[model samples]
Target: MIHLKNVHKRFQKPEGGWFDAVRDTSLHVRAGEIFGLIGFSGAGKSTLLRLINLLERPDSGSVTVDGQPLTALSASALRRARQNIGMVFQQFNLMANRTVAANIAFPLEIAGWQQADIDARVAECLDIVGLADRAQHYPAQLSGGQKQRVGIARALAPRPHVILADEPTSALDPKTTQSILDCLQDINARFGVTVVIVTHEMHVIRSICHRAALLDAGEVVEILSVQDKQVSAQSALAKSLLEVA
Candidate 1:
């Protein structure tokens, strides 16, 4: 339900010339599937994720999600469109002052949801992420894993059609990472939300992704498939990435 065609994104380097973050990349993600963008540091995986929601508008080409051409939308239109797309950041970007319920309620409130409806949705999301008992707790009071669960709950509060997770498990330990991935998988299975995750860890892809695009230096070098918990690597780069897994 997401497509990028000949997309290019660049940023002005403070030193001088421009640096290409995404270079003529094209890919499609099917609805209700978990897709992965795997790459090393500076590989543009994060930039590509932001491009899907136009958080970082592409310098050229098109971005379409759920059949809507996001690149052609006006400011207000884009803002409305973004409500259907949720984002989970690597660093758990929660408000320090807001309680867990309030943090999840923030987006629904901004969407003009009635207080009663927002309250119900926040409770549902908290339950989904296994954080129902922590609703009154502030971000500072939670452990790293609990904070990430709160982030996930907040992202799900809006009933989004797609979730863009940029390194959602990178901050947690191995056991915690497994739980987070399982949570994402459960969300995908139970709710049918399309997930496009950016992660450098091959195990993350193998554990959850059905298909993945391997990127290098701002370009897509390969598209690998995972079946029966096995990743099929076609290119040398893909093989190398798997070797490091």
Candidate 2:
């Protein structure tokens, strides 16, 4: 379970005092569901995601994950906790200098897994993402879809309880995007990992999310649930955005 109550975030404006990025945001994402944070540019979707992992601390509020206060943890403790929280970026953050298996094994190595264990885990992850044949290949040699698959593989390597993806498909074409979304769905269904995705595209939410939180001007304006082929929206902003997307 993930919960944030009255969460707020601010940033210093370029030529002035301050601007709110996220304001009094509160939402809970249930375990084993794919939840989406959807909004247009500058809607604070990414910032809200950062707050969940403490990559960006909230100005004030409680950030509780599995009943643990992430905001109150010591640096070392937070680091340890993060091992079970995987992150997949918009750009596949793979190392150009490393092979696919090596890139996937990076986290296990940091956690001090033995070489044998790392190899086995990396192989399994590769197989899961359908990149077993590309284990020895470099990032530059892969297609965009292939790269994102590798990113998914790397994120799942730790067997994390939750996966946070930030605009992961924004860089891909339609067909590629669908494949990536399918991969995410597969992981959630097969592993029971709670997945929270940040996306501006409404089709993304419509396609895979069990529930979605709509944000506008730093605040959550609506929450939409997708079930039985019906999508209901309570906020005008959400309805408008849905129409546009």
Worst 10 residues of 2 by lDDT: 227-236
For residues 94-179, write the lDDT of model 2, one tens digit per residue. 89999999999998998889999999999999999999999999999999899999999988998998999999999999999999
Candidate 1 has its poorest 10 consecutive residues by lDDT at: 233-242
RMSD of 2: 1.0
Candidate 2 local lDDT, residue 202: 84
- What's the CA RMSD for each of the models? 0.7, 1.0
* Alpha-carbon TM-score of each model against the true structure: 0.99, 0.97
Per-candidate local distance difference test: 0.94, 0.92
Q: Candidate 1: which pairs clash?
A: none
Candidate 1, after superposition: displacement of residue 72 in Å? 0.6
lDDT, residue 185, candidate 1: 94
